[model samples]
Target: MDPEGSRIQDDPYIQVMMAGSTLRKVKSRSWKKNRYFRLLEDGLTIWYKSRWAGRGHSTFSVTDLEAVREGHQSEVLLSIAEEFPAELCFTLVFHGRQGNLDLVAESPDEAQAWIQGVRKLIHKTQTMDEKERLDQWVLDWFHKADKNKDGKMNFKEVKKLLKMMNVEMNEDHALHLFTMADKSESGSLEIEQFVFFYKMLTQRDEVWKVFQDYSEDGEKLMLEELESFLSVEQHEGEQSTQHAQELIECYEPSETAKKQGAMSLDGFQMYLCSQEGSIFKPEHQDLYQDMSQPLSHYFISSSHNTYLLEDQLRGQSSLEAYIQALKRGCRCVEVDCWDGYDEDPVVYHGHTLTSKILFKDVISTLKEYAFRASEFPVILSIENHCSVEQQKVMAQYLRQILGDMLQTTLLDGQVPQQLPSPQELKGKILLKAKKIGGLEEYLDETCTDEVSDEEEMANCDAEMASTEDSPEKKSKAKSKMSRELSDLVVYCKSVHFGGFEHARSHAKCYEISSFSESKAKKLAKEAGTDFVQYNTRQLSRTYPSGLRTDSSNYNPQDMWSMGCQIVALNFQTAGLEMDLNDGLFRQNGCCGYVIKPDFMRDGNTQFSPDKPEEREGYKPLRLSIQVISGQQLPKVNQKEGSIVDPLVRVEIHGVPQDQAKDETSHINNNGFNPVWNETLDFTIHTPELALVRFVVEDYDKASRNDFIGQYTLPFTCIQPGYRHIHLLSKDGTAIPPSSLFVNISISELT
Candidate 1:
């Protein structure tokens, strides 16, 4: 549907909620002000009442906006006859540069319906690419350029349109564009031709620079040059030349059929952005990073409550959450199973309003999507809350669904002093849950001796209460488990981490344990060296605390610093912490595992999170970064004309002992070609622990700044030399070549 023509009444979802009324427009809160909003097919239309509010009206995409229920003062009826809950409003949260908008429904029923309607829209929008979004933006602004309604735009109007897209064209270029777009020599551009011309012109501008960079005498590349470039640089495997030949044929078939051996600018553009030659360079950057390492010697990408999409309470849980996490390269997924309505077990937040999905469905989902995105072994972190019968069903379902993909034996029947590498367990699923009767055999089995039996029982009661205090918990807490489920626990054993001393005790097999952030931090601070030594042999997972009700994530670096193998995060949320997680795990073919630092892997080495690891690579390093041009910088939605004065801020986030902070410079209004021509330098003491994030923001004189896009990566994974940094959206979706072109180098200063 055309965005301009979309109305709320056209949507059946909206019609059911609003009852076919002409009440498409309503009052919503935006940026602390009341704004009139219209529900469009693609997004909500927002406009302020004040005429000079800079941004009079704009559309925020449903893909970037999520409707979440709010519990603050949501009074549907002021003076109610029947008593009701105080809060019933929903906040339209956006996962974009735009701030959140608030909407209140007349009743709780209406609020839920509206939430469902908007959520459906949000899901629909995720499929849309920024390219299509840009097209819509152009169409929205083009009518202004096509004045007098003759369905054509003259050269002057075309020039104005270019400026809106952050393209500055002089008279010579303007006339050339007019001539090219007006293929019939009509002296003006028709709408369809205008769109085609915009796409081609933008593509040309982006690809032309690279063409000039690689071309000699400022022209196209010969077939031999193209083949050499591909074979030597871009292609990963042994068939670079063959792939190059195929690429040339696909893009420059005309020249090839004529027996010419050249690739023009158009051909170059097609080749550069094609799947065969993606600028993001999907190939693994480091050969060593991709090599398999012991599961205990690497940090695994993991998610907490892999079922929940929103908050812990009342959030919708689905198999899609597991799919999303796995798709983003999460290898460890949490599935909290409880007794269901029948023979099948269910997965959800134990005692919350969150919806539940069948345990069989979740296991089947894990089996289907486990290695599809990441080839490494997957660990199903099971939080068991089922009765003996239900637990039997859970085990049965796992065996039935996952089949032989589940790992049932220790590698070679003997637990290695160190855990098996991910390579040894490829395509295997490891169940991580506590075994009921295995502790007596493995006497030194991860039992914490610090607490007495009475204290342990009391603690278990408290834990049960904390998990869920309902009558369901009472029945499930004392349930017996089948020997079959116990047999499935081969590698990932759920054990309580005692003191550091017991962790390094004898006869300890490939047992794994978990700690909340608080407990992990306390243990690390209290026994830093022992923590490091223990991790060398056993794997430890650090999860976010129960206090994170919003599903927000905590920084995994502190846990990583302590050599915790699996620093699990809420993969459903996108923030600085998740950005760091994504960046750290981005290497190694994004197989969801990264080899730990050498010091952390050394069994006898003593290290502390409080200090830099005393290793061979320690040095005072100087990093110099040149802020160069950006490609297709998004327009500022809050501005009058979707314009922006762009700026780049380079931030170094690491330990306090490390070097400088955020350094920024503004290149007023030239978002398309922002150049500081100046290099920002930082001296870091702990180079390995540092994270460098590049944030692009729009400058506002009288108001707070607006975000444009950002790219964050660990210091170790950063590639030097002139390169294009593909940006990600606030929700971590690939924004493609909407990127920064910059030169980076790291030098040892001391």
Candidate 2:
């Protein structure tokens, strides 16, 4: 099927977009101006420019855009709603950190036309297969290089196109390939001829050599040979024979090859680039983990200060941040509630310049998106700072807005020794706040009527009570918690942490504790075995320290290694910490929960991150990775006539003894097809807790290296044999065809 729709000419919206229209581009209320916008013939780019500015235009690819929102859904459009009707306004949301574009059409029809048209384009781009996307990318570049309105490109234009594509080719070799592709001898190449030239330039000699090593003949692989390859190289075991037949049927390009039960070079390469050939195992791509275990026996995806979009000090608090976090499979989210105008409660970081958002609006947003990505229960961690009156209002919004989605009662009306599983509590939102009393105390209504100021303020983090303020001043700010709010806390009740032994004796399964990053690290280092044991039966959340005013995150791998269930991170920040968080939750259907390793889930098991070798049945594994080559890597500098000198680094993040990093030598002046063939090996003491990160950077000797792309996955998910590690941008979005081709081998260390 044609990914851009089987029939593009029949759509009216696409037709209107092709014809173009005038829109009022809005950056702010006073910056709105008229601009002419149109979709180019390639159907992958949108160009717009000021009607009065001569020869100055801008263009953005359809692939760069994430979605198009109708009406005034964005903050920029909402700020100007009084000047324009909602129907006449729209917003274009780009991928990653790119700012959104707000536009107002002259009429509602025009607004709807652009909105629906761009949405269709996005859907088509998403549906394109890897091979189809590569072909479209090549064609897009061909169009960019055509220069004139003509449908062909001359040798000079082709040479310029090579630079644009991040390729620094030798003049003689480039001329030879271009002349050979231009078989018509017209001194100019058409689109088809350009594609031929691209193929000749990107021929994978490394892959060809590996293929020749297995094939009886140089051209193709027989059925038995393919089976042997899968068994020996891919570690397919007894299933290799069946997998071989499936590969031949799926990837074999020639009908004759399929009939003869063989695979040609093109077929073999296709098989290698397919999802089956990727580093992550195909089985682990789905929901393979055990979700029926107790809730405490899982590593839950969590976010700290979920309302903030930027720095905690002065960033904007937005409802969209909650929606973004939930959509990214965050099972736990924190909201700090304080008093607001009109006797309502607002969420924001206290003692900071951050903006505030209504508590009711946040609840509404959570209700709409809490289960959109994962059906597992969501824990709403409330840091309450409201007065008694506003606390009542906040409780009312939780019940009214969330309706039946809120888990306000004990499951089966009975308090069990252990908490419920995620599968059992699906489609419910659990409130993690201060409760007046225990579950047994709730049986008597009179005993659980009121919460003291100390109990109420215990849910607040250390930052909430600033050291600059005197004790008397801080006491004056504290307020009592209303009974309505205290009653809403069901499973996840927050309490102050005592010693590990105290928790084991007095803590209930329904109660949880929150620790600052520094405090948690101290406890983990002092009593690692006790921390792991406590987490087996009860949940514990670890959040960033109060000093992280910039909203930075600590390494979550440290907490996960010790069985910390809710290691909340600043979801607004994008870095190695966020990358590892995303990588850990990318498995098990991204349901926001992954079952803890067996030792961590066992109450009596002795497993410490500091002493992994002492664990029962401990067997270390030796991992070997061969960095073969790179393909179509992006250039860091956008300057003209510039190329990147790229290098690949492989890092293992896990137990301290297993932590290691190795890199390949830099390949100068080449971001395309740089061959390393360097093998880096490591001995992993605890493979279950290990994460492997492959990073590609523009190497610089005098200064820090510039990031190109990276990919991280669990060490257990790494598939053996030849594989393609598809790279991602700094913001965690896929940069297709920009990948590292490598071979992997794993075995038990002697």
Candidate 3:
């Protein structure tokens, strides 16, 4: 049979077991009706088919000889010689009697041992329920010859179901088994692609033994390994969608402080009470009454109680003591005009005010306290102590009695007038203007006689030949003759005339107040006026003398460094007691206190308190004492002598003259270097003496003393150490005892 059809074309299970024995040898002569069968057990192989339509030929038909004698005959010939142990050849065929049978084998377990020797010759005459219905018709013919149903039977769907069991498929193998079980181009088969194409063709070698046991170690089956093979249904829905996007970006709240109620609570308690002492005690008074829920605005006066309610509304009137000190929270108030006759503006305070207080009874008590020109805005400093034409007729009757709420200036460019004329009203009503004698009378009336004396000696020989060929136009003609003598000495001291040719013909109007550089280099060398009007102690006595006590060219390491806005102080003499470590007063500049309020009381009290009060009652005395300036005093040294019983003895022979055993032997002396004098001496007792105490054992304990004021010591004293002495008194008594020896030398003074 052509060598058994070339051993069934070299084995696709021996070409499906010799094409099912050539369709059962042409099923009884040219296949009376197709019917083919092959089955093998153990080393598996199964094939079967049946069909009938025309052709007639019926011989061995006793149910086809009892299904070829008992279907899967003896379980496929006793497992085909124990599963085809190896060598086996093949050849077999049958036909004509309306039955078919064929067999051929070489390998494939000898074509499954010749289809298990023809199912052991049809199991010696079938039975066992007809061999379990022919083993489920050969396991549904190998599960319909699996296409891409990836279980195992691979050989291209067993050569397309053996050409549809010889029906011969065409249309390109039925479009390659309808797109090979449709691997997703969605044409069909998706029951997991028909159970992976029937387990890869009936478990092809158990589909490579479960893909080499889950791809052995070269790992890769992703989508998180098919989502851990669908473990716990996709990790709890990806952790509940990442915790709902972190609760929508944590706690919302920011749309511009929620539409400007600026997070309420009365605008955060007025921004925490504008900071300074931020009031809110009593254990945070329930967190300041829950952050002041409704209180809107109320700073209730500060800046030193608003300058003491503007100095008690300048000598009281119906400010009813400044509206009772602004209901106890006072804020600046002062006022005090004069010029009255009918020209109105009255108020009060010294300089012959025979009786005043009008300005319409202080604008009818600020219009009966409805006080709202934007909520109590009344800053009236005013003081015009009299004369510059009666203070411009009391600043035009206080601008016709507070018109435009009296912010001052009677005319000429209206308000903003700080003194060019309106005569010096000491109590300060702002009026500035006079800056340094109006450029020393505009360079003595513009170089007086307009440069005569031979054109000022030919313009000083053409400024010494243009200062070496125009040194910047000889410094712009000496800065235009020192800015025309510093603007004519600040326009003759702003109308208070006097110099600069008596304010260049009786000052009509002038103002300027600064510019000096030594009066502008002496008004560019005497070409004219040199108006002056100093003050910071006459500008520190016109500076230039080693720069007037050069405090190392004045820097002093920012002295005490804070916001130094002080502004005035000079108290050097005029009744000197002001103590606080007496440097008179200037550390960090501009401090005041020149006492003598009759030497500050207490010489047997009597109604004193000129301000500082409130002690144990409710805070407010604000006492910070310590002043010290008169150029930091200290410089005495010791001279005017004449010692008699003056005192300065120290001969302590192993001490012990009781002053508590010489102050406990000078506090348990050790290597005795209490600064100065040497070994020993004693004899200090001084009753109503006069001040002569000295003690120095280890004097070079590096120099100290720089003394300056505060002194006291005439009695009780003691101290003993190495020693020193030298007073003199036995009888001479010149003057060394009216308390003379005043050495005071404690260094550091700048």
Best by TM-score: 2
Can you write out model 3's per-residue Cα lDDT over 376-407, one digit (the tens) per residue?
Answer: 23323233333334444543444454445432
**Global Cα lDDT for candidate 2:** 0.88
Q: Best candidate per lDDT, number?
A: 2
Instruction: Score candidate 1 by TM-score against the native.
Output: 0.69
Off by over 4 Å in 2: 1-6, 28-31, 454-478
lDDT of 1 by residue, 1-750 (tens): 355326534666655543421111222222223334445322433223333356566555454564443533211222221333334455565543233444544466666666676676665555544334555555655665675668788887777776766655566976776788788787788877787677666654534665676677566677666666654444234675666567667766355432566777666655554433432334454435634567888888988888987888788787768877887789999998887895778899977899888898788778878998777799998888776677778888888888889987666765466577888888999998756434334434454423343433332322233332456654544455555576677777666555677656643556677777888888877888788888888888888877788988888877887888788888777787888787777776778888877877888886665666365466768888876567777676734345667888887776545635564677666555565656788887776667787788888888988788888777876655455677787767656447776666677785
Candidate 1, 466: how far from true, in Å?
9.2
Ranking under lDDT, best-scoring first? 2, 1, 3
lDDT of each: 0.67, 0.88, 0.26
lDDT of 1: 0.67
Shift of residue 491 alpha carbon in model 3, Å:
10
Deviation in angstroms for 590 in model 3? 8.2
State the TM-score for model 2. Answer: 0.96
Root-mean-square deviation per candidate: 10.0, 2.2, 50.0
